[model samples]
Every structure is written in structure tokens, then in C-alpha cells.
Target: MKHTVQRDWRVTRPSRKSRFNFDQTTALGGLTVALFTYIIYHFIYPLISKGLLW
Candidate 1:
């Protein structure tokens, strides 16, 4: 029995330094905002509601 494995891969030498992709940047920005809001909702909102923080 003969088994053959097919591979598809490519390697390239980039001519210039790659910048952050736009879609990735947007996704990161959204994640950051969501985390920040969640932090406030989880920790800071409770403090304010109980009159412990202004």
C-alpha cells in the first residue's frame, strides 16, 4: 500500500516591514473598549451605587 501526502505551503521574503492590518486593528480596538466597559460595570459601578465612590 502506498500513501501520498499532499502539502500546500508557501514562504515569502517580505520587502518591507508589515504594518498592523486594518481589520485586526479594528477588532482589537473593539475588544479594548468592551473590556474597559466591563471593568467599570463590574468594579466601579457597584462602588458608586453603594455610595462608596463618587
Candidate 2:
């Protein structure tokens, strides 16, 4: 008597194609916006409020 093994196709399919990385893109965009806002509020706003930046 002999035995054989079977494999499932679904387990290996994702390796062939990359899934859309929307999560990463969104997180990066949010971080960039936060950084820009922080810079404007902390550095630029202070200068403007003091009537030094023009």
C-alpha cells in the first residue's frame, strides 16, 4: 500500500501577486501631514505671531 499527500492552492497564491498597500500609504501620508502641520505651528506660527517672519 502507498499514500500520497495533497496541497491547498490558496495557501501559496498570495506569493505570486502583491496586494494593494493602501494601509501603508495612508499611514505615511498621515505622518507627513502631521509633520508639516507641526512645523508650521511650532516654527512658522511663532515667527509670524511675533511679527518677525513677515
Candidate 3:
């Protein structure tokens, strides 16, 4: 006896524009980096430092 399974697949279509708007992407990336840095310094850095020392 043979059994067959059914599956559904989905594909995402790409945008037609070949060139990216770098200015917006770069600005958003910079903001994200700044926010991540602030959080790490405020919360994570102290914990890591204490772990390393003791």
C-alpha cells in the first residue's frame, strides 16, 4: 500500500523597483542601532561586567 500527503506552498513576489531607497533604510538602521546600544548599556552591560568580575 502507498500513501500520499498533500501540502500547500506559498511564494512571495518581489518588487519591480531594482534600486533601493538607501536614505530611509540607513536612517532607520541608525535609529535601531542607537536604541539597541542604549538598552545594552543600561541593562545588559552591568550584568556582564559583574559576571566577569566575580
Candidate 4:
């Protein structure tokens, strides 16, 4: 028995540009930090302060 693959059935991938430049990356990083800080302040900080962080 012989197995063969077709050349026409190729997978194509998307190309990447300079979408993650310094400004964009920095903005995203800052946003992520702010979001994490907000979550900790609203969720974790209260629990810890109330001694319910067990």
C-alpha cells in the first residue's frame, strides 16, 4: 500500500505586522497591571483585611 498527500491541501497562516510596538505593548502592560490591582483591591484585600482569607 502507498499513501500520498496532495499539494493543493496546504494550510495557510496569517502574517504578523508590527502590532506589538513599544507604545502598544506598554499600554497593554499598564492596563493589565491596573486590572490586576483593581481585582486584588476589590476581592483579595477585603478578605485579607477581614481575616477571611483562609
Candidate 5:
């Protein structure tokens, strides 16, 4: 005679505070920084260069 054990169909996964992934967060952060840099370079820099922002 042999004994067998059954496992749950759903494997338990590690819990998280949020569903957002770290990779996505990093990607979004990078994109945001890039956008800000572009804005500053193309738009704000001209104002600063002409001393219009002062």
C-alpha cells in the first residue's frame, strides 16, 4: 500500500504591496526623466538663454 498527497491547483505566490512590477516602474521613471530633459532642452533652455525666465 502507498500513500499519496494532493496539492492545490493554484500555487501560492509571493504577496506584494502593489501589482505594479519593478521593471515597469523603472521604465516609466526613465521615460519621465527623458521627457523632462527634452522639455527643458527644447522649451525651457530657449527662455533661459534669452534671459526671459528671469
Candidate 6:
């Protein structure tokens, strides 16, 4: 019987030139605003209306 050897997987790091243009602060700020707006309008508003009686 022939035995097969499994090779270890390795992650390749990207070059500096291929890095993101936007800084972490800007990226986080944009993402935070977008997520907040989406959750408030689509999720929170609907749930709030359900709990109110008029």
C-alpha cells in the first residue's frame, strides 16, 4: 500500500503596494455610519412600531 503525505497549508502575504488606500479610521467610520443607519431604519424602527399601541 502506498501512503500519501499531506502538505501544510500556508497563507501568502500581500505586497505593500497592493494594500488598501483608505486608512483604518476612515474605513471604520464609514462602515459604522452605514451599519448604524441600516439597522436603525430596517430593524429598530419596525420593532419599535410593533411594541406601540395606538
Per residue, candidate 2 scores C-alpha lDDT tens digits across 1-54 of 678676664665555455755578899999999999999999999999999999
Candidate 3 weakest ten by summed lDDT: 6-15
User: How many clashes in each candidate?
Assistant: 0, 0, 0, 0, 0, 0
lDDT of 6 by residue, 1-54 (tens): 989886755547754674567789989999999999999989888888998533
lDDT score for candidate 2 against the true structure? 0.85
Per-candidate TM vs. native? 0.56, 0.59, 0.47, 0.56, 0.57, 0.44
Supply the TM-score for candidate 3.
0.47
Identify the leading candidate in terms of TM-score. Answer: 2
lDDT of 1: 0.85
Model 5 vs. true fold: TM: 0.57
Q: Candidate 1's residue-wise lDDT over 1-54, tens digit each?
A: 889775745546645556955578899999999999999999999999999997
| Number of residue pairs clashing in candidate 1, backbone atoms closer than 3 angstroms, sequence gap of 3 or more or interchain | 0
For model 3, residues 1-54, the per-residue Cα lDDT tens digits are 778775645446754665765578899999999999999998889989889635
Q: How does model 5 fare in lDDT?
A: 0.89
Worst 10 residues of 2 by lDDT: 9-18
Clashing pairs in 3: none
Q: Which ten residues in a row have the lowest lDDT in candidate 6?
A: 10-19
RMSD of each: 5.6, 8.4, 8.8, 7.8, 9.5, 7.7
Q: What is the lDDT of candidate 3?
A: 0.80
Residue 54 error, candidate 6, Å:
11
Candidate-wise lDDT, in order: 0.85, 0.85, 0.80, 0.87, 0.89, 0.82
TM-score for candidate 4: 0.56
Scored by lDDT, model 6 comes in at 0.82
> Per-residue CA lDDT of candidate 4, range 1-42, in tens?
889887785448754567665678899999999999999999
